[model samples]
Target chain A: MDEFSFINSIKQHSYKQSSLIKGIGDDAAVIRQPTQDIVCAVDTLVEGVHFSRQTMEPWHIGYRALAANVSDLAAMGASPAFYLVSIVIPKTWSSGEINQIYVGMKQLATKFRMDLIGGDTVSGQELSVSITVIGYVERNKARYRSLAKEGDKVFVTGTLGDSQAGFHILTNPGYYTDEVYYKERHQQPLPRVDFASKTENISRIVFNDISDGIANEANEIAEASKVSLILYEKQLPIKDSYEQFPPKLQHKWKLFGGEDFELLGTVSNKDWNELQIIAKETNTPLKEIGYVDDSQSNIGQVFLHENKQTYRLQKKGYTHLK
Target chain B: MDEFSFINSIKQHSYKQSSLIKGIGDDAAVIRQPTQDIVCAVDTLVEGVHFSRQTMEPWHIGYRALAANVSDLAAMGASPAFYLVSIVIPKTWSSGEINQIYVGMKQLATKFRMDLIGGDTVSGQELSVSITVIGYVERNKARYRSLAKEGDKVFVTGTLGDSQAGFHILTNPGYYTDEVYYKERHQQPLPRVDFASKTENISRIVFNDISDGIANEANEIAEASKVSLILYEKQLPIKDSYEQFPPKLQHKWKLFGGEDFELLGTVSNKDWNELQIIAKETNTPLKEIGYVDDSQSNIGQVFLHENKQTYRLQKKGYTHLK
Candidate 1:
């Protein structure tokens, strides 16, 4: 379809929010933010690098792009408010395919109660979707990756490695069993927006989303907080589907195969029990797998415990360069 | 360059602001808004479509990307606060080349007092820079394209057609003289951020940025406001640099060639003189080219007047598809 037609079709899917004074159809979207602080993040997913059209549906690609940005906001304990999407599509694609992408965006946007405010759509050689999400949090209450303190217990929400397993099944469709479950996880990740309200009583919490694998994220927390993370491999909450794989393969994926979109965070030991109680009350699975140490020698380091032996992880997680 | 090193190289250049609670190196960027209302807009620039690496420097590409977003904010009459950039580059690009892009972004960011807040860096087949800019405006003061009133005088900032002319020279160097002037205009069209303050006294001002040429933008304003825009050909602000072209060629570029990045708007005839005075005081060149009309037959139409004859424009200006 032509640009005007494409824009008109998606305009029907844009939902209005009270804070949004003017959305879409304007030079810029105007919003009256209810709060003083807002969290912002952006992520771009390109064809061939983030997804393959042959392996995934257009809707799933759109869903994953927004999901990545939502996960970033979740890490900050921010409530999703509005998002802008900039999409570039190849000329060969039909208008229907483009509509499906927005359909996917509308589905998730409805769930999060966020508005599709403003963006640009253009033609390019490769299909790419870039999303900017704006979220809000209470003053001085937003979580940070650098807030993990010595003696804090590291915890994660939900099971790890599911997205990676789903990705494997998607890319190698014939090689894996339980394809539906893994593909669904890979295609649609549930951002931990519920985590913010659930753990409101817990203080001194530092959090990050697991997009670059647990090991790498753990190292990031350690480096930013100037502490060491000692993760117990046996305690990792690997998904049941991932356990079907060989132990080594499961371990590798758990540590290095990123895109899980789960919340990885640390809380002071004093508040850990309160957080666990809240998680249980909220019906969210919370796993404690490590603790932060203050030793300078181990700062910026991640140690893995397996078979009653501790080993430092020397390899970094998945890099976008690949 | 690897993602980590690339992120570090640009981190030093990132400026800090009082409203920014956190900038980069975290789950997301946190900013404190001083105003109750904020404006946001996003745009993406793709290689081969927006610019060619062979014809433009990496820094210029970066500058243009941010400039486009800034222009959008300028149209809304907001003060730019911060911006996020999502850049995708081919793996073959060197660290130095990537650094140059950030250098260009930093240069513009500094001039506008906008901080490079947060974004994603990923690999893709082609280079694309997507920027989301956040700006603040006084409550109920932001301009809208849909606010134009009948009998309102249409005004354009600076001159038009220079960018299109520059683009021609850049693509076909041998065909044009005064290459320096045109090429510079094409490479960097100054965003009219200064217009917001200059027109503060005008009670009923509607604005839009002229990225899609006068004919297209006039039609947009007409359609949005349900009015007709009548243009006086002699009143069109054709740049002196563009005057060297044949009259026909100059008119063609003025009407159909876009990327001028000038402010286009309408102010009530009663307030027009005051606006012009303020524009002169601010040292901003503002030209009155036409007036909004209340003709039902000409609703959503643009009529160009030349030599006492009026003609309708049947063709739209440059579209991304072309």
Candidate 2:
């Protein structure tokens, strides 16, 4: 299909939202702001760097792209509203393949109730999907990474390391034949939008999505908030399926693996109990793996407690830039 | 520089706006909506497709990317506000080169008072810059392509075909030594945001940016509004610099060349005189080249009047999807 036909095919998938005045078929999309503040985030996924065509389906690529941007909004405690996607694809791809990609995007958009308002598609040497999501939040209710305070507990939603293990399985095909769950985790990450809404009423809570591993994001919060993070390895919430791997690999993946799309945040000690109850009510797996502390010498330092031995945790994660 | 350092280097360039609650260095950027409605547009530029490194400077590429998206908002008569950029570059590029690209973006952003709020940078085989601009417009004042009425006078701002000629000169160096104006026009087409603002008070006006040439965009306006557009070829806004080229080349570029980034729209005969006065005060060269007519038999058709002869104008332009 040509550009116009491809746009027409996917345009039907865009749903009408009360705030959206115009979507697609226009020079720019028009949307009414439901609240005072709007949250915006952008993320790009490249063909080989973010995903390989040999290991993943086109639909999964599309789903993952939108999921990553939605994860950013989830981190900000914003309600998903609209998304603009810029897709660069090779000319050799079939129209069916392109439609499948949009199918994946439409499925996720419907689940999140987001309007695919505006975007552009162009021919390129490789496939790259870049998405920018816009959402609305009350001025005072929006969460930020710089709100963590000393003595606040660092919490994460859902199990960790599954996405990394999934990546390994996808790359080394026959190596983990029984780890279908890991592969699925990597390909289809559920953005924790529902969980974020449950904690919207709680004040002074800081949140960020774990797109670049817990260690990397932990350092970001620590530096931004002028605090230090101390993580206990024993408290890391590793999934039961992850136990099948060797302990060393499990530890590596749990601490440094990215693309989990789970929410990593901090809540004041006073609200910890209340948050736990809410998490349980919402069916969100909340785990306390670390705590914030005043920096003594090394500001923004991260400490790892493993087997009762404390060591400095290096800031490292899945980085596409060398 | 590492990803963090690279982000930090550009972060300082983000100017503070009162409506911007948060800018960069977080999971997402937050902005307070100053108006009831927001306009959003996204466009992507790829190396060797939209530009080439040998023919264009890195800064020009970055400037062009944002300019294209800004043009969309101008067409909708929206005030330029915030933008999110996603850049995918080869790992071989230097930090200085990347900084130059941001420098180009910053120059334009500063001129328009637009905030470079949030984006992601990733590694890819080739360079691609995708930008999504968010602007504000009052609900009643926003223009649409579907609002053209029969007998409305069609108008355009500034000269057309300059960008295409600039592209030619840049690619074919030394061919037009004195035509530096065309080269600059192509590399940095100014978005007609100020002109759009000047005509905000005009009622029943339809607007679109001449990015894909007048013929192509005219066809869109005709089909969208269920009308026919008849253009007098002698009224086509070809710059004096464009005369140096052969007549055939000049005619082709003026009619079919894209990326001029000028506004094209229609206003009722009553508002045309007032619009001309406003355009002059704003230093915008507004020209009437055509008129919208009731679609009697050939609905959504465009006709060209040239050399005492008239014929149907084909709907075609510079499409990257070929």
**Which digits, one per residue and each the tens of the lDDT, describe model 2 over residues A1-322?**
3323433432424332344443443212334455545677788999889888876798998888899888888887777776777888787776567666767886787787776656777879988999988776665676777788889999999999989889888777675644878888898888988888677778888888888788877887887777888888889897866887878888788888878999888999999998899888979899999899986775777788776677777667322211
lDDT against true structure, model 1: 0.74
Looking at model 2, the pairs that clash are none
Q: Each model's DockQ?
A: 0.21, 0.21
> Which 10 successive residues of model 1 chain B have the least lDDT summed?
B21-30
Residue A102 deviation, candidate 1, in Å?
A: 1.2
Show the colliding residue pairs in model 1.
Answer: none
Ten-residue stretch with the least lDDT total in model 1 chain A: A21-30
Question: Best candidate, TM-score-wise?
Answer: 2
What is the DockQ score, from 0 to 1, of model 1? 0.21
True contacts kept of each: 0.40, 0.41
| A92-131: candidate 1 lDDT, tens digit per residue | 7776777677778767877877766666777788888999
TM-score of each: 0.87, 0.87
